[model samples]
Target: IPFGFYLFLKTENYIVGWIATLLTGLMVLYAVYTKSLAAWVSISVEAIVFISILIYLVKTGKYQFKIKSRLYALVLTFTGFLLLINIDSGGFNLKFGGLSDQVTSVQEFVQSKSSSGVDVVRSDAAVKGQSSIEWRWSVWLNSMAMIKDNPLIGVGAGNYKIEYPLYNHKVVRDTKFNLESQLDRAHNDYIQAAAEFGITGFVIALWAVVCFYYILFCLFKSDLSDLPGKKLLLAAALMSAGTGMLFNAGFSFPFQRAIPPFIVMLIFAIACVMHAQKIKTSHTSIIDTRLLYAVTFVFTLLFFYIGHYHYTMIKADKYFGRTIRCYNNGNWPQLLNEADKALSYNAGRKRVLFYKGFASNELGKIKESIQYYEELIQYFPNYINGLLNLGIAYGKVGENAKAVETFKKIIVLMPDEGGYYSDAGHYLTKLGKLDQAYTYLKKGAELEKENAIILLNFGVLCMQMKKYSEARKVLKKVAELEPDWDQPKQYLKYIKEQT
Candidate 1:
């Protein structure tokens, strides 16, 4: 579509170009209003670039305004006015509001978290109130930290998820703020590139963008009296696409995905086609049959390799999906089988290892489960699920010391998590360390006041310590929190009998 549009522009079809621009501009405006902040920023950059090029052509007398061009121009003008009115009415305020909110959030975060390093932008308020903003900012901060730590050669491509927890801010850990999803991408392509490929990779990417615009500029300056309108329109479209990519990279990991990169490659291909046409008309050269054949063969081999890689990835994904279904259905044997199949296709998949560990635990293969969890933790030390399950496995195998230590480590990794404290306290209670148990239980209660389970446990602990009054109060609160629960009432009854 982009190539065809470019060709239309180069053929002096100003009507087509103007109509296409208007339609695309309207779509982009709608996306900005309805979609994410990154969408707004990206499309806005494209619009700016497109408009700038249009103005430049007008100033240079390259673009001659015709009667038909004015019709599309009027439509585009009306559309712009409509969008502007919508913006004024607060329909697309998220773009501006989100930015202002972020600034305020950051200021509040810094003021409250004075002790935390600048590398760590952790704030309980930000995490609780503006979770999305906080999450993105946190990821960016961690990515920058990663870049600083490995400026020459990054952590490695596709290894950000593995390395993220190591750079997780202490405030996030202390608050036990659980993100709804995994932080796979840094959410900024430039930062991700720097973190994955180091400073050299980042510079190379910048150089590519510079070269793209430089080529466009040269093309724009070329004599196009034969089809001046076509050249001007094509230049504007190309400039719009390039500028969009530049802005998108600053705030989005578009290169990590397929579609955005594909669009970019398509634009580049169109530019190459235009350049080739220019060369063909200007200079005649003898064809090198041997070079042509060699190029074809090399491309053939490259395509074959790409096909095989994608095939393997698809098989891996299929098996992984099957494994998840089995796990969800509690089919331990099927889960293990599917996980094994996935590993055969894509060895050392972290999630597959997790499933293997879980299935082993369910199958009563305690030793095997422990081994699997240990292996997983070796690769993903900060994986909460692996650590949590490993601790449970240890407890099941009568390795109380290991279990206690594992829970303690979980507390350190997620200090503000009441559940870890509660788990540790439960283990301490089993070990008859009443004082230690009380301390942890109390801390857990303080952190998660609304947790009925923690409150019930604390109440029971108080009873064990022979603090009758404390037990009564805690038990009463649990009863009130869970009105219809029989356990809290039974505990309250026991406390009454004791009194």
Candidate 2:
């Protein structure tokens, strides 16, 4: 609808303009009613850009803002305000469930993360459920830290995940939410760009935006009376698109996604086509009919190849999904079979390697699992789960030193994670490196105070070091934290008997 209105203004077609305006109104109303945050924000920004252009045109005496356009703009502005109110009112669920529920959900989320020793804002649990917002914040924070360190050229494109855990915030690592999962994107395009391309890339991106606006301004100022209102309309539409990109980038990595970038290119292409049509005279011959037919044939062949590639990708994805379900169910043989099928369709599928490794491990093929993990790591060295499982496989094969080294590497990759610390400490203790084990265990306990397992491990380590008082205190805290867990109580009694 936004684009259609631009086209209407450019062509001076009243029927197209009114229809586009009505559809745009309906879309805004729907976005408001559905409480789609992204849609609301983008649409509101687009409306503001359009209205700003209209105001500029009227004030500069270049064009008149008709009463109809004024009404549309006013309604759009009103809808935008309503959306803002809904957002401020916590999704406006108070009328249905009372404000107390919303308030309590926020309180619980805050308390959960705060008590877990993470000083981060927790989103409304009623809306976001558990931990996702915190996770995204962690990713953003880590990405920002990385940007500070590698401000010039970033860690490189497609390398965010490789650098993510290395720069992960301490609070994020110790939060005990989806600790096994790896974060691939920062969820903010601008931040992602800085992390991937560095300061140079960021400056380039800024320059592009500046250039876009400059071009738009030039178009607006162009004397195109022969084209009649085309320049103003085109400028407004492009401005709206630019505004949408700016706002959307704050919360989404849209540049990494397919459809958003495609739509952007399509819009530019349309603008070019329109401009070309306006400049072309009756005698203009851009291309001969034979050349046009040849170009059409080449494009058709290219599209066919692309379509076939995507079709195969879809099939491989289906097999991959089946593999995941089998893995979740502990059906190793079925998982392996499905994963093999997926790989057959797409040999470069890295996710399939993870599943294959996991399935091999479950089937007690430790060597095969190690091989799979090694291959997976060759492709994506920073894969957290692959590193973790590979370490376990090494331990199973009695490669204690290699296992300890692997765990240490994990610690370097994710320094704040209590699990990695505990694992490394446990392996060290097994290898009779009690002093090193104690150091890691103590740090793990400090970072993961509420973790019953880590606390229990730390208490045991105290007992091993013959510090009866420390053992008693640690065990008592664990018991208090997990009242129903019998293990801490058992350990506490054992410590008391030793004392």
Q: TM-score: which candidate is best?
A: 2
| lDDT tens digits, residue span 201-245, model 1 | 889988988877777776788677433566558767877886787
Runs in model 1 deviating more than 4 A are 1-26, 29-34, 67-126, 170-180, 221-229, 269-305, 428-442, 455-499
Please list the C-alpha lDDT of all candidates, in the order they appear: 0.75, 0.74
TM-score of each: 0.74, 0.76
Clashes of each: 1, 0
**Local accuracy of candidate 2 as per-residue lDDT tens digits, 201-249:** 9999878667656656666665656344646676678778867877877
Q: In model 2, which runs have C-alpha deviations exceeding 4 angstroms?
A: 4-22, 33-38, 65-138, 170-177, 224-226, 273-308, 450-453, 475-499
Residue-level error in angstroms, candidate 1, position 423 = 1.8
Clash tally for model 1: 1
lDDT of 1 at 26: 57
Worst 10 residues of 1 by lDDT: 170-179
